[model samples]
Target: MRNTQQRKTEWLNIQWKGGVMTHPVQQDGSSCGVIVVLMAREIMKAFPNVPILQFGTSRKEMANERKMMALQILKASVFDEAENCSMCSLKKPTGSVHRFINWIQCDTCERWYHEKCLGMAKEDLEQARANTWSCILCS
Candidate 1:
């Protein structure tokens, strides 16, 4: 197993280059690799164990899948955090102790939610441990 930090770097170093990312870019290379690596670090920290599927034999397919996986990871992390927000209650009286979750997001699709409107439990939402949480729509 690769070190977590190095693993992240290696994954992000991959890029779409003339339909193949195996070769390093000789020009404008340093910036793109660094940017992607940093983005990967943020995404991996936010979402763990996101599936990366590549069915086609082409390198393009592999590259696309990797990009999609990274996007999904970021989406998962965003949704996981949004589900716990407690600002969604519209009918609650002002100065209420309970902070309603106003912006809940679907873990699969990245759809936003209004807690009360979406009929989700605050406790249940807050108790979610993984970024793979699914919303009612996705479920």
Candidate 2:
């Protein structure tokens, strides 16, 4: 067994290095987050049996998984309803799965809008997560 000081040192080392992880790599870099989700689901579903690292998920399969997940989310969002973009009045954003989540809320009114609907540049709109933003109406 490790001593207290040795354990603490190990913990600090892991934290500094963002914690060690081993997982299957995505062919295309962009699908890492999605792949992680699929892997977690597979782990839960296939418990007792270790998750196969090579589930034969090609880029196309990953794309299909993402779409399926998005559709599932859209159907049953947030306990009941999906938030609609105030500008477009659409529940889902228009674009790829990545862009489907490009929503921002007014710090004042708390209404959500598609980032594109606000006509704001990506850098300009999503500057900082902590930064408070208001819609035109709120402003």
Candidate 3:
């Protein structure tokens, strides 16, 4: 039966009296939820003895930590996916030439490979636009 404002006020009062503090305002509205979750987890991990309400970290520091964590996770996922690929035997292809070419992916194995590795010419790839090319292992 409590109104929203009254509920919020009660919550704030509880937090204030309990020594729980507020995190800084998010710079962007888009990732506020993510920031809050990440900050809470990090704070809990770093300061288990401290009350969460009393624990505070700068928004800049939290954002930087979040960014770095995201990058590390992404890199790890990429590495895992590359390891799963049977064609290159876990070695990612090097050189700008490999980057420029339109790589084909296997439907069955979900592994990616260069046209040259599959013995498919550029013209052949162009000609077989609508056809799905399966890798040799899958074929």
- Candidate 3 has its poorest 10 consecutive residues by lDDT at 9-18
Model 3 regions more than 4 Å off: 1-24, 51-66, 76-79, 85-110, 113-139
Q: How many residue pairs in model 1 have overlapping backbones?
A: 9
lDDT of 2 at 75: 72
Report the number of the highest-lDDT candidate.
2
Whole-model alpha-carbon lDDT for candidate 3: 0.60
Q: Pick by TM-score: which candidate is best?
A: 2
Error of 3 at 31 (Å): 2.4
- Compared with the true structure, all predictions reach lDDT values of 0.51, 0.72, 0.60
Question: Per-residue lDDT of 1-139 in model 3, one digit per residue for the tens?
Answer: 3435834644433443456445365545455666667668767877857534432345666677678778877877645543334555444454434545556777777777755555677687776556776778878
Segments of candidate 1 deviating more than 4 angstroms: 1-101, 129-131
lDDT of each residue in 88-118, candidate 1, tens digit only: 4234434446664245566676655555555
Q: After superposition, how far is residue 52 of candidate 3 from its true place, in Å?
A: 7.5
Quick one: ranking by TM-score, best first? 2, 3, 1
1-139 per-residue lDDT for model 2 (tens digits): 3435834644433434466454456677578888788889888887989977555567888889889999998777643223778887776666536634677888878888877777887687867235988778878
Compute the lDDT of residue 96 as modeled in candidate 3.
31
Clashing residue pairs in candidate 2 (N, C-alpha, C atoms within 3 angstroms): none
